[model samples]
Target chain A: MSINAYLAVGLGSAMGSVLRYSVSLASMVMLGTHFPWGTLLVNVLGSCLIGWLAATASRAPHGKLAHWQPLLVAGFCGGFTTFSLFSLETLHLAQQGSMGLALLYGIGSLPLCVFSAWMGERLAFSHPPAA
Target chain B: MGHGITSVLLVALGGALGGIGRFAISNAMAHALGKAFPWGTLCVNASGALLAGWLLGVYGVANTQSLWLFAVAGLLGGYTTVSSFSLQTLELWQRGQAIRAALNMVATLLLGIAMTALGWWLAQG
Candidate 1:
Protein backbone atom coordinates (compact mmCIF):
# COMPACT_ATOMS: atom_id res chain seq x y z
CA MET A 1 0.00 0.00 0.00
CA SER A 2 2.63 2.51 1.00
CA ILE A 3 6.19 2.97 -0.19
CA ASN A 4 7.31 1.40 3.03
CA ALA A 5 5.29 -1.69 2.30
CA TYR A 6 6.89 -2.02 -1.09
CA LEU A 7 10.33 -1.62 0.39
CA ALA A 8 9.63 -4.24 2.99
CA VAL A 9 8.45 -6.77 0.43
CA GLY A 10 11.43 -6.10 -1.76
CA LEU A 11 13.91 -6.47 1.05
CA GLY A 12 12.25 -9.55 2.47
CA SER A 13 12.06 -11.13 -0.95
CA ALA A 14 15.74 -10.46 -1.47
CA MET A 15 16.60 -12.25 1.73
CA GLY A 16 14.24 -15.11 1.04
CA SER A 17 15.60 -15.61 -2.43
CA VAL A 18 19.12 -15.76 -1.08
CA LEU A 19 18.04 -18.30 1.48
CA ARG A 20 16.38 -20.41 -1.18
CA TYR A 21 19.61 -20.45 -3.17
CA SER A 22 21.59 -21.52 -0.17
CA VAL A 23 19.18 -24.28 0.68
CA SER A 24 19.09 -25.56 -2.86
CA LEU A 25 22.86 -25.53 -3.11
CA ALA A 26 23.15 -27.33 0.18
CA SER A 27 20.60 -29.93 -0.84
CA MET A 28 22.35 -30.55 -4.10
CA VAL A 29 25.62 -31.09 -2.31
CA MET A 30 24.19 -33.35 0.34
CA LEU A 31 21.70 -35.34 -1.67
CA GLY A 32 21.95 -34.89 -5.42
CA THR A 33 19.64 -33.54 -8.10
CA HIS A 34 18.30 -37.01 -8.84
CA PHE A 35 15.24 -35.88 -7.01
CA PRO A 36 14.47 -32.20 -6.60
CA TRP A 37 14.74 -32.27 -2.87
CA GLY A 38 15.93 -28.66 -2.67
CA THR A 39 12.91 -27.01 -4.24
CA LEU A 40 10.60 -29.33 -2.36
CA LEU A 41 12.20 -28.46 0.95
CA VAL A 42 12.04 -24.72 0.38
CA ASN A 43 8.51 -24.72 -0.98
CA VAL A 44 7.19 -26.78 1.88
CA LEU A 45 9.08 -24.73 4.45
CA GLY A 46 7.89 -21.45 2.99
CA SER A 47 4.33 -22.72 2.93
CA CYS A 48 4.59 -23.72 6.54
CA LEU A 49 5.97 -20.34 7.58
CA ILE A 50 3.33 -18.42 5.68
CA GLY A 51 0.59 -20.51 7.15
CA TRP A 52 1.94 -19.99 10.64
CA LEU A 53 2.22 -16.25 10.17
CA ALA A 54 -1.21 -15.92 8.64
CA ALA A 55 -2.86 -17.94 11.38
CA THR A 56 -1.01 -16.10 14.09
CA ALA A 57 -1.93 -12.76 12.62
CA SER A 58 -5.58 -13.71 12.40
CA ARG A 59 -5.66 -14.57 16.12
CA ALA A 60 -3.73 -11.52 17.23
CA PRO A 61 -5.76 -8.82 18.95
CA HIS A 62 -4.28 -5.99 16.96
CA GLY A 63 -3.78 -5.35 13.28
CA LYS A 64 -0.19 -4.29 13.81
CA LEU A 65 1.25 -7.60 12.65
CA ALA A 66 -0.94 -7.47 9.56
CA HIS A 67 1.35 -4.87 8.11
CA TRP A 68 4.08 -7.44 7.78
CA GLN A 69 1.96 -9.63 5.51
CA PRO A 70 3.42 -8.19 2.37
CA LEU A 71 6.93 -8.67 3.57
CA LEU A 72 6.62 -12.13 5.01
CA VAL A 73 3.85 -13.77 3.05
CA ALA A 74 3.87 -12.10 -0.31
CA GLY A 75 7.56 -11.40 -0.54
CA PHE A 76 9.56 -13.84 1.52
CA CYS A 77 7.58 -17.03 1.07
CA GLY A 78 6.65 -16.16 -2.46
CA GLY A 79 10.28 -15.61 -3.37
CA PHE A 80 11.64 -18.52 -1.39
CA THR A 81 9.28 -21.10 -2.89
CA THR A 82 8.97 -21.15 -6.63
CA PHE A 83 6.22 -22.82 -8.65
CA SER A 84 7.96 -21.99 -11.89
CA LEU A 85 11.12 -23.91 -11.25
CA PHE A 86 9.19 -26.79 -9.80
CA SER A 87 7.21 -27.07 -12.97
CA LEU A 88 10.33 -26.68 -15.02
CA GLU A 89 12.09 -29.44 -13.17
CA THR A 90 9.15 -31.74 -13.57
CA LEU A 91 9.13 -31.04 -17.25
CA HIS A 92 12.81 -31.84 -17.46
CA LEU A 93 12.29 -35.16 -15.76
CA ALA A 94 9.41 -36.05 -18.03
CA GLN A 95 11.34 -35.07 -21.11
CA GLN A 96 14.12 -37.34 -20.06
CA GLY A 97 11.53 -40.18 -20.10
CA SER A 98 11.59 -40.56 -16.38
CA MET A 99 7.85 -40.34 -16.54
CA GLY A 100 7.49 -42.21 -13.28
CA LEU A 101 9.72 -39.77 -11.49
CA ALA A 102 7.99 -36.83 -13.12
CA LEU A 103 4.61 -38.16 -12.17
CA LEU A 104 5.78 -38.74 -8.65
CA TYR A 105 7.10 -35.21 -8.44
CA GLY A 106 4.00 -33.68 -9.94
CA ILE A 107 1.60 -35.52 -7.72
CA GLY A 108 3.75 -35.10 -4.68
CA SER A 109 4.29 -31.31 -4.61
CA LEU A 110 0.73 -29.97 -4.32
CA PRO A 111 -0.40 -32.19 -1.49
CA LEU A 112 2.86 -31.76 0.36
CA CYS A 113 2.77 -27.98 0.17
CA VAL A 114 -0.89 -27.76 1.04
CA PHE A 115 -0.52 -30.17 3.93
CA SER A 116 2.54 -28.33 5.18
CA ALA A 117 0.61 -25.08 5.26
CA TRP A 118 -2.28 -26.75 7.00
CA MET A 119 0.06 -28.23 9.56
CA GLY A 120 1.63 -24.87 10.13
CA GLU A 121 -1.72 -23.22 10.67
CA ARG A 122 -2.75 -25.97 13.03
CA LEU A 123 0.52 -25.79 14.89
CA ALA A 124 0.20 -22.06 15.40
CA PHE A 125 -3.35 -22.31 16.67
CA SER A 126 -2.84 -25.59 18.43
CA HIS A 127 -1.04 -23.82 21.26
CA PRO A 128 -3.08 -22.25 24.06
CA PRO A 129 -4.70 -18.98 23.13
CA ALA A 130 -2.50 -15.99 23.70
CA ALA A 131 -3.72 -13.79 26.55
CA MET B 1 32.23 -15.25 -10.34
CA GLY B 2 32.78 -17.54 -7.39
CA HIS B 3 30.44 -18.30 -4.54
CA GLY B 4 31.27 -15.89 -1.77
CA ILE B 5 29.96 -12.81 -0.03
CA THR B 6 29.95 -11.01 -3.34
CA SER B 7 27.88 -13.76 -4.91
CA VAL B 8 25.37 -13.56 -2.09
CA LEU B 9 25.14 -9.83 -2.54
CA LEU B 10 24.64 -10.28 -6.23
CA VAL B 11 21.85 -12.76 -5.63
CA ALA B 12 20.26 -10.41 -3.11
CA LEU B 13 20.33 -7.54 -5.54
CA GLY B 14 18.94 -9.72 -8.29
CA GLY B 15 16.24 -10.92 -5.96
CA ALA B 16 15.30 -7.36 -5.11
CA LEU B 17 15.05 -6.46 -8.75
CA GLY B 18 13.07 -9.60 -9.53
CA GLY B 19 10.67 -9.12 -6.66
CA ILE B 20 9.91 -5.56 -7.69
CA GLY B 21 9.50 -6.67 -11.24
CA ARG B 22 7.07 -9.42 -10.22
CA PHE B 23 5.02 -7.05 -8.10
CA ALA B 24 4.76 -4.54 -10.91
CA ILE B 25 3.93 -7.09 -13.59
CA SER B 26 1.30 -8.87 -11.55
CA ASN B 27 -0.35 -5.60 -10.61
CA ALA B 28 -0.35 -4.43 -14.20
CA MET B 29 -1.80 -7.72 -15.45
CA ALA B 30 -4.51 -7.65 -12.80
CA HIS B 31 -5.44 -4.16 -13.89
CA ALA B 32 -5.74 -5.26 -17.49
CA LEU B 33 -7.15 -8.77 -17.14
CA GLY B 34 -9.50 -8.20 -14.22
CA LYS B 35 -9.51 -10.33 -11.04
CA ALA B 36 -11.73 -13.25 -12.00
CA PHE B 37 -8.71 -15.52 -12.40
CA PRO B 38 -5.18 -15.14 -11.16
CA TRP B 39 -3.81 -14.40 -14.58
CA GLY B 40 -1.11 -12.28 -13.01
CA THR B 41 0.33 -15.06 -10.92
CA LEU B 42 -0.05 -17.59 -13.69
CA CYS B 43 1.85 -15.38 -16.07
CA VAL B 44 4.58 -14.76 -13.55
CA ASN B 45 5.04 -18.42 -12.69
CA ALA B 46 4.95 -19.60 -16.25
CA SER B 47 7.40 -17.01 -17.50
CA GLY B 48 9.73 -17.46 -14.59
CA ALA B 49 9.85 -21.22 -15.20
CA LEU B 50 10.67 -20.74 -18.84
CA LEU B 51 13.36 -18.29 -18.02
CA ALA B 52 14.87 -20.57 -15.41
CA GLY B 53 15.11 -23.44 -17.82
CA TRP B 54 16.64 -21.32 -20.54
CA LEU B 55 19.06 -19.63 -18.20
CA LEU B 56 20.28 -22.93 -16.82
CA GLY B 57 20.68 -24.30 -20.29
CA VAL B 58 22.61 -21.27 -21.46
CA TYR B 59 24.76 -20.96 -18.38
CA GLY B 60 25.31 -24.65 -17.66
CA VAL B 61 25.34 -26.01 -14.11
CA ALA B 62 28.87 -27.29 -13.65
CA ASN B 63 31.03 -24.33 -12.67
CA THR B 64 28.63 -21.41 -12.50
CA GLN B 65 27.35 -21.38 -8.99
CA SER B 66 27.26 -17.61 -8.85
CA LEU B 67 25.35 -17.38 -12.09
CA TRP B 68 22.89 -19.94 -10.83
CA LEU B 69 22.39 -17.90 -7.67
CA PHE B 70 21.85 -14.64 -9.52
CA ALA B 71 19.69 -15.92 -12.34
CA VAL B 72 17.85 -19.10 -11.40
CA ALA B 73 17.80 -18.75 -7.63
CA GLY B 74 17.52 -14.99 -7.21
CA LEU B 75 15.89 -13.52 -10.26
CA LEU B 76 13.60 -16.31 -11.40
CA GLY B 77 12.91 -17.47 -7.87
CA GLY B 78 11.80 -14.01 -6.80
CA TYR B 79 9.76 -13.60 -9.92
CA THR B 80 7.76 -16.81 -9.34
CA THR B 81 5.57 -17.86 -6.41
CA VAL B 82 3.83 -20.81 -4.79
CA SER B 83 2.38 -19.24 -1.64
CA SER B 84 0.06 -16.92 -3.50
CA PHE B 85 -0.91 -19.70 -5.81
CA SER B 86 -1.80 -21.96 -2.91
CA LEU B 87 -3.71 -19.22 -1.15
CA GLN B 88 -5.65 -18.32 -4.24
CA THR B 89 -6.56 -21.92 -4.93
CA LEU B 90 -7.81 -22.32 -1.39
CA GLU B 91 -9.80 -19.14 -1.67
CA LEU B 92 -11.39 -20.28 -4.87
CA TRP B 93 -12.36 -23.62 -3.40
CA GLN B 94 -13.79 -21.92 -0.36
CA ARG B 95 -15.83 -19.60 -2.54
CA GLY B 96 -17.40 -22.57 -4.39
CA GLN B 97 -15.48 -21.95 -7.57
CA ALA B 98 -14.18 -25.48 -7.40
CA ILE B 99 -14.00 -25.84 -11.14
CA ARG B 100 -11.97 -22.70 -11.67
CA ALA B 101 -9.77 -23.66 -8.79
CA ALA B 102 -9.01 -27.01 -10.34
CA LEU B 103 -8.47 -25.42 -13.69
CA ASN B 104 -6.07 -22.89 -12.30
CA MET B 105 -4.08 -25.50 -10.45
CA VAL B 106 -3.86 -27.96 -13.30
CA ALA B 107 -3.29 -25.46 -16.07
CA THR B 108 -0.56 -23.57 -14.29
CA LEU B 109 1.38 -26.68 -13.43
CA LEU B 110 0.99 -28.25 -16.83
CA LEU B 111 1.68 -25.13 -18.80
CA GLY B 112 4.50 -23.95 -16.60
CA ILE B 113 6.32 -27.25 -16.93
CA ALA B 114 5.69 -27.50 -20.63
CA MET B 115 6.99 -24.00 -21.21
CA THR B 116 10.08 -24.64 -19.18
CA ALA B 117 10.88 -27.70 -21.19
CA LEU B 118 10.33 -25.75 -24.36
CA GLY B 119 12.69 -23.07 -23.20
CA TRP B 120 15.30 -25.60 -22.31
CA TRP B 121 14.90 -27.25 -25.67
CA LEU B 122 15.22 -23.95 -27.48
CA ALA B 123 18.34 -23.04 -25.60
CA GLN B 124 20.02 -26.15 -26.87
CA GLY B 125 19.93 -24.87 -30.40
Candidate 2:
Protein backbone atom coordinates (compact mmCIF):
# COMPACT_ATOMS: atom_id res chain seq x y z
CA MET A 1 0.00 0.00 0.00
CA SER A 2 1.14 3.55 -0.67
CA ILE A 3 1.86 6.05 2.08
CA ASN A 4 -1.39 7.79 1.25
CA ALA A 5 -3.26 4.53 1.63
CA TYR A 6 -1.67 3.82 4.96
CA LEU A 7 -2.45 7.30 6.14
CA ALA A 8 -6.02 7.02 5.00
CA VAL A 9 -6.53 3.73 6.79
CA GLY A 10 -4.91 4.88 9.99
CA LEU A 11 -6.79 8.15 10.13
CA GLY A 12 -10.09 6.47 9.34
CA SER A 13 -9.43 3.75 11.89
CA ALA A 14 -8.64 6.21 14.62
CA MET A 15 -11.83 8.13 13.99
CA GLY A 16 -13.86 4.93 13.69
CA SER A 17 -12.56 3.52 16.94
CA VAL A 18 -13.32 6.73 18.73
CA LEU A 19 -16.87 6.74 17.40
CA ARG A 20 -17.42 3.11 18.36
CA TYR A 21 -16.30 3.75 21.90
CA SER A 22 -18.36 6.88 22.26
CA VAL A 23 -21.53 5.29 20.97
CA SER A 24 -21.03 2.23 23.15
CA LEU A 25 -20.52 4.37 26.21
CA ALA A 26 -23.57 6.40 25.41
CA SER A 27 -25.62 3.30 24.76
CA MET A 28 -24.37 1.65 27.89
CA VAL A 29 -25.36 4.66 29.94
CA MET A 30 -28.79 5.13 28.43
CA LEU A 31 -29.69 1.68 27.20
CA GLY A 32 -27.57 -0.13 29.78
CA THR A 33 -24.37 -2.08 29.22
CA HIS A 34 -26.14 -5.42 29.09
CA PHE A 35 -26.62 -5.23 25.31
CA PRO A 36 -24.56 -3.31 22.81
CA TRP A 37 -26.51 -0.92 20.62
CA GLY A 38 -23.27 0.67 19.60
CA THR A 39 -22.18 -2.28 17.53
CA LEU A 40 -25.66 -2.83 16.16
CA LEU A 41 -26.00 0.77 15.11
CA VAL A 42 -22.56 0.80 13.65
CA ASN A 43 -23.05 -2.44 11.71
CA VAL A 44 -26.52 -1.57 10.48
CA LEU A 45 -25.48 1.91 9.47
CA GLY A 46 -22.26 0.68 7.95
CA SER A 47 -24.17 -1.81 5.81
CA CYS A 48 -26.52 0.88 4.55
CA LEU A 49 -23.74 3.30 3.75
CA ILE A 50 -21.64 0.65 2.10
CA GLY A 51 -24.66 -0.45 0.08
CA TRP A 52 -25.35 3.11 -1.01
CA LEU A 53 -21.75 3.69 -1.98
CA ALA A 54 -21.74 0.45 -3.92
CA ALA A 55 -24.92 1.49 -5.71
CA THR A 56 -24.09 5.07 -6.52
CA ALA A 57 -20.33 5.55 -6.68
CA SER A 58 -19.13 2.56 -8.72
CA ARG A 59 -20.86 3.71 -11.91
CA ALA A 60 -18.68 6.74 -12.25
CA PRO A 61 -15.09 6.58 -13.41
CA HIS A 62 -12.39 6.47 -10.79
CA GLY A 63 -10.90 9.78 -9.64
CA LYS A 64 -11.24 11.55 -6.29
CA LEU A 65 -13.82 8.96 -5.31
CA ALA A 66 -11.26 6.22 -5.73
CA HIS A 67 -9.28 7.36 -2.70
CA TRP A 68 -12.36 8.24 -0.71
CA GLN A 69 -13.75 4.68 -0.71
CA PRO A 70 -10.79 3.29 1.18
CA LEU A 71 -10.93 5.94 3.84
CA LEU A 72 -14.65 5.52 4.47
CA VAL A 73 -15.27 1.84 3.71
CA ALA A 74 -12.06 0.02 4.41
CA GLY A 75 -10.60 2.18 7.10
CA PHE A 76 -13.62 3.51 8.94
CA CYS A 77 -16.01 0.67 8.21
CA GLY A 78 -13.41 -1.99 8.86
CA GLY A 79 -12.54 -0.43 12.16
CA PHE A 80 -16.08 0.38 13.19
CA THR A 81 -17.99 -2.80 12.41
CA THR A 82 -16.85 -5.21 15.11
CA PHE A 83 -17.97 -8.71 16.13
CA SER A 84 -16.82 -8.40 19.72
CA LEU A 85 -19.59 -6.02 20.56
CA PHE A 86 -22.04 -8.34 18.87
CA SER A 87 -21.02 -11.22 21.11
CA LEU A 88 -21.17 -9.05 24.18
CA GLU A 89 -24.61 -7.79 23.29
CA THR A 90 -25.94 -11.28 22.73
CA LEU A 91 -24.53 -12.49 26.00
CA HIS A 92 -26.05 -9.58 27.82
CA LEU A 93 -29.40 -10.08 26.22
CA ALA A 94 -29.38 -13.75 27.13
CA GLN A 95 -28.56 -12.88 30.69
CA GLN A 96 -31.29 -10.28 30.91
CA GLY A 97 -34.34 -12.44 30.30
CA SER A 98 -34.22 -11.75 26.59
CA MET A 99 -32.68 -14.92 25.22
CA GLY A 100 -35.05 -14.90 22.31
CA LEU A 101 -34.24 -11.32 21.47
CA ALA A 102 -30.55 -12.05 21.57
CA LEU A 103 -30.91 -15.08 19.33
CA LEU A 104 -33.05 -13.21 16.85
CA TYR A 105 -30.65 -10.31 16.85
CA GLY A 106 -27.71 -12.56 16.22
CA ILE A 107 -29.52 -14.68 13.65
CA GLY A 108 -31.36 -11.96 11.80
CA SER A 109 -28.87 -9.13 11.62
CA LEU A 110 -26.53 -10.28 8.83
CA PRO A 111 -29.18 -11.52 6.39
CA LEU A 112 -31.12 -8.31 6.73
CA CYS A 113 -27.86 -6.65 5.89
CA VAL A 114 -27.38 -8.88 2.84
CA PHE A 115 -30.64 -7.59 1.42
CA SER A 116 -29.31 -4.09 1.76
CA ALA A 117 -26.09 -5.13 0.10
CA TRP A 118 -27.92 -6.79 -2.77
CA MET A 119 -30.22 -3.84 -3.21
CA GLY A 120 -27.29 -1.47 -3.24
CA GLU A 121 -25.42 -3.56 -5.76
CA ARG A 122 -28.50 -3.93 -7.96
CA LEU A 123 -29.16 -0.21 -7.88
CA ALA A 124 -25.55 0.67 -8.56
CA PHE A 125 -25.02 -2.00 -11.18
CA SER A 126 -28.14 -1.00 -13.08
CA HIS A 127 -27.99 2.21 -15.11
CA PRO A 128 -30.67 4.51 -16.47
CA PRO A 129 -31.56 4.10 -20.11
CA ALA A 130 -29.42 6.61 -21.97
CA ALA A 131 -30.72 9.65 -20.18
CA MET B 1 -14.50 -6.92 33.21
CA GLY B 2 -16.23 -3.91 31.67
CA HIS B 3 -16.54 -0.13 31.45
CA GLY B 4 -13.23 1.59 31.10
CA ILE B 5 -12.28 4.78 29.35
CA THR B 6 -9.49 3.13 27.39
CA SER B 7 -11.62 0.21 26.20
CA VAL B 8 -14.41 2.52 25.20
CA LEU B 9 -12.00 4.70 23.27
CA LEU B 10 -10.60 1.73 21.45
CA VAL B 11 -14.03 0.53 20.37
CA ALA B 12 -14.90 3.89 18.84
CA LEU B 13 -11.59 4.12 17.07
CA GLY B 14 -11.94 0.56 15.84
CA GLY B 15 -15.48 1.15 14.67
CA ALA B 16 -14.62 4.15 12.52
CA LEU B 17 -11.77 2.39 10.78
CA GLY B 18 -13.74 -0.82 10.41
CA GLY B 19 -16.68 1.01 8.90
CA ILE B 20 -14.47 2.77 6.41
CA GLY B 21 -12.61 -0.41 5.70
CA ARG B 22 -15.82 -2.14 4.73
CA PHE B 23 -16.74 0.75 2.48
CA ALA B 24 -13.42 0.69 0.66
CA ILE B 25 -13.41 -3.05 0.09
CA SER B 26 -17.03 -3.54 -1.01
CA ASN B 27 -17.10 -0.48 -3.24
CA ALA B 28 -13.87 -1.37 -4.91
CA MET B 29 -15.05 -4.89 -5.55
CA ALA B 30 -18.41 -3.72 -6.81
CA HIS B 31 -16.70 -1.36 -9.20
CA ALA B 32 -14.26 -3.89 -10.52
CA LEU B 33 -16.65 -6.80 -11.07
CA GLY B 34 -19.77 -4.87 -12.08
CA LYS B 35 -21.95 -7.38 -10.22
CA ALA B 36 -24.96 -7.47 -7.92
CA PHE B 37 -23.79 -9.80 -5.11
CA PRO B 38 -21.75 -8.71 -2.08
CA TRP B 39 -18.43 -10.28 -2.90
CA GLY B 40 -16.59 -7.52 -1.12
CA THR B 41 -18.30 -8.10 2.20
CA LEU B 42 -17.83 -11.85 2.00
CA CYS B 43 -14.17 -11.38 1.25
CA VAL B 44 -13.69 -8.90 4.04
CA ASN B 45 -15.59 -10.89 6.67
CA ALA B 46 -14.11 -14.24 5.72
CA SER B 47 -10.57 -12.92 5.55
CA GLY B 48 -11.07 -10.99 8.74
CA ALA B 49 -12.37 -14.12 10.44
CA LEU B 50 -9.38 -16.18 9.41
CA LEU B 51 -6.92 -13.60 10.62
CA ALA B 52 -8.79 -13.05 13.83
CA GLY B 53 -9.12 -16.75 14.54
CA TRP B 54 -5.40 -17.09 14.13
CA LEU B 55 -4.62 -14.05 16.21
CA LEU B 56 -7.04 -14.79 19.04
CA GLY B 57 -5.89 -18.37 19.42
CA VAL B 58 -2.21 -17.50 19.35
CA TYR B 59 -2.53 -15.00 22.14
CA GLY B 60 -4.97 -17.06 24.13
CA VAL B 61 -2.80 -20.13 24.13
CA ALA B 62 0.56 -18.44 24.50
CA ASN B 63 -0.68 -16.36 27.37
CA THR B 64 1.27 -13.47 25.97
CA GLN B 65 0.14 -10.43 27.85
CA SER B 66 1.01 -7.91 25.19
CA LEU B 67 -0.42 -9.99 22.39
CA TRP B 68 -3.49 -10.70 24.43
CA LEU B 69 -4.23 -7.05 24.93
CA PHE B 70 -3.07 -5.35 21.78
CA ALA B 71 -3.38 -8.00 19.11
CA VAL B 72 -6.06 -10.24 20.53
CA ALA B 73 -8.37 -7.85 22.31
CA GLY B 74 -7.76 -4.60 20.47
CA LEU B 75 -6.90 -5.67 16.97
CA LEU B 76 -8.51 -9.05 16.35
CA GLY B 77 -11.61 -8.36 18.36
CA GLY B 78 -11.97 -5.11 16.53
CA TYR B 79 -11.34 -6.72 13.20
CA THR B 80 -13.71 -9.67 12.66
CA THR B 81 -17.49 -9.20 12.74
CA VAL B 82 -20.13 -11.81 13.54
CA SER B 83 -22.82 -9.16 13.14
CA SER B 84 -22.23 -8.68 9.44
CA PHE B 85 -22.07 -12.40 8.89
CA SER B 86 -25.25 -12.95 10.86
CA LEU B 87 -27.05 -10.27 8.91
CA GLN B 88 -25.83 -11.64 5.62
CA THR B 89 -27.01 -15.16 6.41
CA LEU B 90 -30.44 -13.94 7.45
CA GLU B 91 -30.93 -12.09 4.20
CA LEU B 92 -29.98 -15.16 2.23
CA TRP B 93 -32.40 -17.35 4.12
CA GLN B 94 -35.15 -14.80 3.82
CA ARG B 95 -34.67 -14.79 0.08
CA GLY B 96 -35.17 -18.58 0.11
CA GLN B 97 -31.51 -19.30 -0.36
CA ALA B 98 -31.69 -21.30 2.84
CA ILE B 99 -29.16 -23.90 1.84
CA ARG B 100 -26.46 -21.40 0.95
CA ALA B 101 -27.20 -19.37 4.03
CA ALA B 102 -27.03 -22.37 6.33
CA LEU B 103 -23.82 -23.50 4.73
CA ASN B 104 -22.35 -20.08 5.15
CA MET B 105 -23.18 -20.02 8.84
CA VAL B 106 -21.89 -23.50 9.47
CA ALA B 107 -18.79 -22.92 7.44
CA THR B 108 -17.94 -19.67 9.12
CA LEU B 109 -18.39 -20.98 12.63
CA LEU B 110 -16.65 -24.27 12.05
CA LEU B 111 -13.77 -22.89 10.04
CA GLY B 112 -13.35 -19.93 12.31
CA ILE B 113 -13.08 -22.14 15.36
CA ALA B 114 -10.73 -24.49 13.60
CA MET B 115 -8.49 -21.65 12.49
CA THR B 116 -8.41 -20.36 16.03
CA ALA B 117 -7.24 -23.74 17.19
CA LEU B 118 -4.60 -23.83 14.50
CA GLY B 119 -3.27 -20.50 15.56
CA TRP B 120 -3.19 -21.59 19.15
CA TRP B 121 -1.27 -24.72 18.28
CA LEU B 122 1.17 -22.81 16.15
CA ALA B 123 1.79 -20.28 18.85
CA GLN B 124 2.23 -22.89 21.55
CA GLY B 125 4.55 -24.94 19.39
lDDT of 1 by residue, A1-131 (tens): 56776787788889988898789879989999788898899989988888777878888846666767778877888788888668767876877799999999987787677677867778888986444
Computed on C-alphas against the true complex, the DockQ of each candidate is: 0.63, 0.25
Point to the candidate with the largest TM-score. Answer: 1
Residue pairs with colliding backbones in model 1 are none
Candidate 1 local lDDT, B36-89, one digit each (tens): 888998999888888877875687554246677677767888889887777666
Please give the range of 10 consecutive residues that has the lowest summed lDDT in model 2 chain B: B60-69
Off by over 4 Å in 2: A91-98, A118-131, B1-74, B81-102, B109-125
Total residue pair clashes for candidate 1: 0
- Single out the weakest 10-residue window by summed lDDT for candidate 1 chain A: A61-70
Q: Which candidate number maximizes lDDT? A: 1
lDDT of 2 by residue, A1-131 (tens): 46577567656655665665567557767897555666677777666656655445555546455548657655665565665444434434655689788777766665565565566555655765121
